[model samples]
Target: MDRAEVTELVLSAKRMKGLTWKDIHEKVSVSTSPIVVTAALLGQMRLEPNEAAKAAELFGLPEEAQILLTEIPYRGSLTEIPPTDPLIYRFYELVMVYGTTWKELIQEEFGDGIMSAIDFDMTMERQPDQKGDRVKLQMSGKFLSYKRY
Candidate 1:
């Protein structure tokens, strides 16, 4: 399709009933910006086969969207989602704001090998704080040791 046609579809998808971009992002499990989503709609970038299927399930995309998964995308991601995606930035911000206690704690428990995010488990909890509120993230994964034993 042409540029205007593509953009109109994107905006329509963005507008579709009771749904919000934030909600779509959560369901889709990807760090997305307007630009990323738009490009994905316009076929400038691909969603990966699995991600395309998820997008279809989440956003209820059309059959045309299937081809988009194979398309090579333009550069996506504006800011990193943690420092990066503002939604997940709380933990990193906590590190900077609260201090390196988290770092030292990890080092003490884990020894040296870093935990693999790829093979990791993640949980987010909301707990009451003395001052107000907090977003707590708990992550656990097998330690991948550098020194072979």
Candidate 2:
């Protein structure tokens, strides 16, 4: 089965079993964050063979679905260029407005290197406020400098 089919099966099983991503992640014992585990379930990341088997056992997935989980997926499933969803669009707008500022600050502080998403960690939390609760997004990525040819 393709990644999409596997994703559907996973979602169906999750709904039927009333399982959360955190539940599956913990049960599967995958050495990754819940968000990463969710990404794998959504067919955005590849899982190791053992991890796939664990996930299959936890989600009642078939052997073919486990195989699909271990295969590399075509990441970035967004069909639109600038996301149409309001929440996601807000991020796009933030980048449009502060992209230059972020670039300048990062370059000044970290040299001509860029942050590596491959070696990144992110967390989303709620911050208490007088007016209303605010979102706190913490992201850390390794800084990689350009290699001189």
Provide C-alpha RMSD values for all models, in order. 7.5, 1.8
Runs in model 2 with CA error above 4 Å?
none
True-structure lDDT of candidate 1: 0.59
lDDT of model 2, residue 31: 75
Which whole-number lDDT from 0 to 100 does residue 45 have in model 2? 86
lDDT of 1 by residue, 66-93 (tens): 5555466544334564576665576568
TM-score, each model?
0.46, 0.88
* Candidate no. 2 TM-score: 0.88
The CA-based lDDT of model 2 is what?
Answer: 0.88
Report how far off residue 109 is in candidate 2 (Å).
0.8
List candidate 1 stretches off by more than 4 Å: 1-15, 20-51, 57-64, 67-89, 97-99, 125-136
- State the lDDT of candidate 2 residue by residue for 4-122, as single tens digits: 99999999999999988778888775577877788889999888888899989987888999999989899989889799999989999999999899889999999998988889898
Give each model's clash number: 7, 0
Q: Supply the TM-score for candidate 1.
A: 0.46
Best by TM-score: 2
